[model samples]
Target: MRSRQFGPRVSKDGVSFRLWAPAAKRVDLLLDRALPMQRRDDGWHAVDVPGLTAGSRYKFRIDNELEVPDPGSDFQPDDVTGPSEVIDHGAYAWRAKDWRGRPWQDAVFLESHVGTFTHEGTYRAMIDKLDHLVETGITALELMPLADFAGRRNWGYDGVLLYAPDSAYGRPDDLRALIDEAHLRGLMVFLDVVYNHFGPEGNYLGHYAPEFFTAAHTPWGSAIDYRVPQVRAFAIENALHWLADYRFDGLRFDAVNHIFGVRDEIPLLHELSAAVGDLATETGRHIHLVLENGDNRASMLDSAEDPPRGKFRAQWNDDYHHVWHVMLTGESAGYYGDYQDDPRGDLARALSSGFVYQGKRAAFWGGEPRGEPSGHLAPSAFVNFLQNHDQIGNRALGDRLESIAAPAAVAAALAVTLLAPTVPMLFMGEEWGSRRPFPFFCDFQGGLADAVRKGRRIEYEWAYSKYGDEVPDPLAVETFKSAVIDWEARNQSPGKERLALVRGLLAVRHKEIAPRLPGATFGEARAGADGLLTADWIMGDGTRLHLIANLSASELSPPRTRPAGKPIWGGALTDRLLPWSVLWSLGEV
Candidate 1:
């Protein structure tokens, strides 16, 4: 009820259409033909067209000149530019009627992109791969954004129709089927949503309501005006639609730092949290909200107490990824420079506490203080990943770290990511070490096509100029095709080995570590004279777990005294660790 029902409100008897276009002098609902709409006092236009049921496609004829898709389209069956369709969400018979979803304490996430996740690149095709997800020992599947963007394929971040699922992936029912299957397989589905800037093409919101976006800046062009009432309502309502209508387990809020601020910002997140909290209580389902913030706004995390009350349940921790990436690859760029001063110390801090900056002046921010201390937060509130869509695709060539990092070093990073006390999300194809590159790819309209092509080159303008175009054309179909996971790799040499290692580590984590997440704690990573990074920590079961890794190419001696508990994993019990190796001990050392 936060947002006024903006789209067609489906009914057994006809349908009622409403739209807010305060700027428009005339607005009409154009179905088979035009039906004039009466202007309302609340800056909205209303029209009740009888004999219209679900699946009836219609466009709002604004100013009696241009007919465009609904601002709150439930489904864009044809594409982003197509007319919006009325969908009866109650039509489908969903499975898992009794599933309450896996909680944060036991969540091991699989972050996947639907288009490139499989050969077919549809929701039905994605469901076919659920077996691998279950085999990977992940409890949740976090999909990249699926909102309707322009053209046939995209990263989904450029989505304009915020409520409609991408038609490229299949109809609304297909997506629903996929979620149902995932739930049946005991995998909670989380959607990544972009609420910052609308994609360039076919976004008609500004045509009707120009106040949707504000003057604030975001990494993705411009910021959304969270200060506007209807805007806030639309945002919150969209979130609830996903949670209540589609029955998703949670949402991975993309780029939370960009979504609000420059005004009373916290209220947006607060109100959303309150609403979702209420929805959970009513449905007897726990719907989690996660934030992605480079600044680590740990203060926004919901409390650790029972029936937790507050904002988001967790946040993606970039500090962990930044330090880990540097430690393994020794490649530091951009914000990574801040941790180069004491990578191990920073890693240690990230391990023990959730944030490394903690209200201190950030060297990356030109010594401006950022990110309040997160020591008070529970470890589960910090999501850790060695590789994600951005870490891999943002590269000029979209090369996975596995392509460059030493095999052993990659394995060590994987172990740390999964074995750590925090929530872990595995990028698609990461487990089996698929050699495919996940390059940035998109399909845009003609005019925007050239601009997007140029934008890709200019995204890292220096690379395009200096490296002489290190990236492939994002507009090319082959560029998208090349990113698909080679399923054959799972049966081959190094890929098989990598798969075994990943599965083995996940098995160990699920059995020994996952249950302890609610109480697990992390300490800082300390370095020894031999260049080995070591961290001794306590698990939820009061058992001591010691992590020691040799990231260098040469073999090194182990600790003077063995780790507490027996070596549950790795060569921790031995005196020497092979280059780029790690040891995880469980019993007293």
Candidate 2:
């Protein structure tokens, strides 16, 4: 049980390094050292290299056989597997002095991966693209996880080091610059973080601290031991560090269900939420916590007689997206089997009630019934999206919904998602209908790379056995490369049309509906025999809006007696709504 601290320290010439390896008979500073050296007492080994500056690559040579990279390496250009580099995180001059924070309820989030977002695959490169997002009416940006992982090229879910940002995206300062630039443009940034499990390769937390991981296993690897005092502190402290130091507006927790603790009374989620709230108050900035819970549990937001509600601002409503996807595409395979035929009913239920599975058995889950979200929760409490990284990447060929469905249907889905009762999110290039396939790919060292390939194949094989010939190998480099968005596509006719539709929908939502409701009361739609569904939404301020959606492919005019005298902002009568399309209008009679 020995502790080792290796990092850049203040020195006249630069910095010095010291490590602890009591078990080893010998230790040496591998930076510019041709030979190994002996260890000292007090379980400490020291080395002073004045000329070795930050970004210097180094490793530790222990017992002559083990040559490991610096445990605190700031950059790993060669591979995710090797040693670390010395980096002074404090060296960067931050420029986001005037930035406060964006409120979660009002945010329009855009999710993107750093590697594919730009050709350079650096944070600086992403900073240059912020203007496009800002102009597109997006209020916030959600970056995919960048925690230190096994390779320079990865989706980042396989991150092994929780505290370190991926060096492939440039140094810590580069990230700071990106965030600062985004803030300057009035865009709040939310980082995706994984706390459920660590990737298999380059995971050395167990070696550094046995309590860092628990015996309980996850699909990825060992589950973090939140029950242990040290482990609890580590998780909380790591979260606080990102917010306090990096100035990130919020965090999107990867898979919170797996963050299990033995104690029933004090769940790890409660503790994490409390910590985030305290930090937010102390910093005088609003910080949001979002969860990616597939279980559809309502208690996730409930903090009754407990610590502050699991500091989560919202959770992804997968049921809503799944139902919408199924209805639009009419595909029934994998988990979507249950969602095939009856989409209108499920969608209507999800809109009026927060949970679509309320008291209904989940055929795929093989469960009794899932609980519904409390009435107290606002529509903003749910983050809705038609497609995300997983939905696209998990496909056999990693085809996005836009690619599978007709252009008109895709446009209609976007309109429906934007007008829905939840906060809307769009994956990169989704608004413009980018045809790129977001495939699952990895770059790991040695035999680990092959293992990742095999694992991905097995998962997709089982999921898409019906389309055996269509399935693309997840390990193929081309599969991952093809996922990158083509910047040139933004100017095309179809892209422009799709972008305009999204802009129109968002403008209506923000300008007319959002201001009126603040928090509106949702009413179920009563469809006519002609196949038009109509609902009445009354705002908190008594402003009433009558919405009529034509869900069929053929155009059918509503009766002349249908709530007349209301100044219609827009509507589609002769304009046929390709099956699955929706039309929303706002005004008072």
Candidate 3:
């Protein structure tokens, strides 16, 4: 029988194995027999185990004191910290042979937690929901973090085991099955990965080796030492493993602001981007890397050369969501304070420039000014959303946009998100106006769980005391259960109406705007001094579209330059649009 490739398959004759051990002076790869790998000039230890079969189990001995799992392990069955299992990437029976990658611009993201997206909360159960998403016109699905986390019921963000797929969600093969099934249905899958920091529980990196982290402290705890050569190799190799082994089309990086590397250097962001790009070229597959940066830094859109654009395909535009939310809900606590007054200009700027805080001082951030995005980047480079896992789950009660705003306001926001220049995304329940509250919940056991519960309650109570209203306790089982979407509700009249409206808006976008895709031009119209704004898109084929919004409480007159042809949407042109109403129209200018 032919021997299988043991590590990353580079070419027919070459494969690479990497391990992360910063503190160790010497490291050896323990293959079928103990083999001392030669330390490379670049700080990685490697050996070509070409004759070794794919199912071989291996570990690493570092400085004669620690035997740790492979940092780039393809499989880890004996707990997350044990020895790794080498598997042939080509062995899995893939059913998605004709799978073509879904573009970031083509995606309508469905963000949901595996624990609550269905009653079973397993990968298999999620596979059953693919038909619904496919029919709903979503081309891609963004799953919340699913790395092996402690306990069974917590959100996947607190995940500690980066190598092991959560056993609770069914084994590694199960996740592969989920991706394969999704691809078969013409839906791309993007996994939300937490790289800036690991979760609090089952995190055995410290126990095995000190090289996994650095002296720097992050909000989540110790930061990964990306500046260290071995540490960088480990991070990059793990990302490659996910794409090559599991066939994930893309990765949505969580909290990239915390990824601090060497100053005056390319930084890990650019390094990973280049690495992923190289791998994509070799594999002939379209792979995307997205960043979620709270800091509105324009440098993220830079290319590989010069100032070095952060090397990411796209980054989440929080400013757009912040402006939209504040305008509709009229809430100004916390981060919303920066967008409290005259948010129409901010919204219009976000639609035109892709960043609302461009060179503007943020009030909530205390004199910190955000930079503008490079004008050359396409509209798809900015991922805009009014609701996401963070925006909903981080709230005191996890109230969705529909919970806090009127139905008309919610519909307007949806239209704006879908029709704007930036790529649009929708949170799971937002489409049907689901009443569920996606509150924060975890399954930490014993003292840890109790501490989390107490801490969450204290935090919500403090918000209630200051904000003038009590919020729901996050620890309550009812809170988490309430977040489970009522799939049956989609059949009802109100739910169907909301879904149809979204469908209509998306139909207009896909048919009219998206066909123009990267070359569409944008301009904005102001409705007097009250901050009511309208944005227009002129397609490559001379087709004109307009988005008219009334951000203020009262209606405003149309802009001075009215379209010459009949309005495609009559509801938007009617007099006196109530507070927070938005309309989309197609006509000739």
- TM-score per candidate, chains pooled: 0.95, 0.85, 0.85
Tens digit per residue, CA lDDT, model 1, 16-102: 998988788899888888888999776789998778889899999989688899978989988888889999877889778998877
The C-alpha RMSD in Å for every predicted model, in order, reads 2.1, 4.7, 4.6
Off by over 4 Å in 2: 1-78, 262-266, 302-309, 466-470, 516-518, 525-531, 536-540, 557-569, 572-581, 587-589
For model 3 the local lDDT of residue 460 reads 46
Give the lDDT of residue 259 in candidate 1.
74
lDDT of 1 at 69: 92
Tens digits of per-residue lDDT, candidate 2, 557-577, equal: 664545543433346444343
Least accurate stretch of 10 residues (summed lDDT) in model 2? 302-311
Number of colliding residue pairs in model 2: 4
Worst 10 residues of 1 by lDDT: 302-311
Candidate 3: which stretches are off by over 4 Å? 1-19, 22-70, 75-87, 262-266, 302-310, 373-376, 450-479, 525-531, 552-556, 565-581, 587-589
Evaluate model 1: give its lDDT: 0.81
TM-score for candidate 2: 0.85
Q: Indicate the residue-level lDDT of 121 in model 1.
A: 94
Candidates 1 and 2 compared by lDDT, better number: 1
Candidate 1, superposed: residue stretches over 4 Å from native: 1-4, 262-266, 303-308, 363-366, 462-466, 587-589
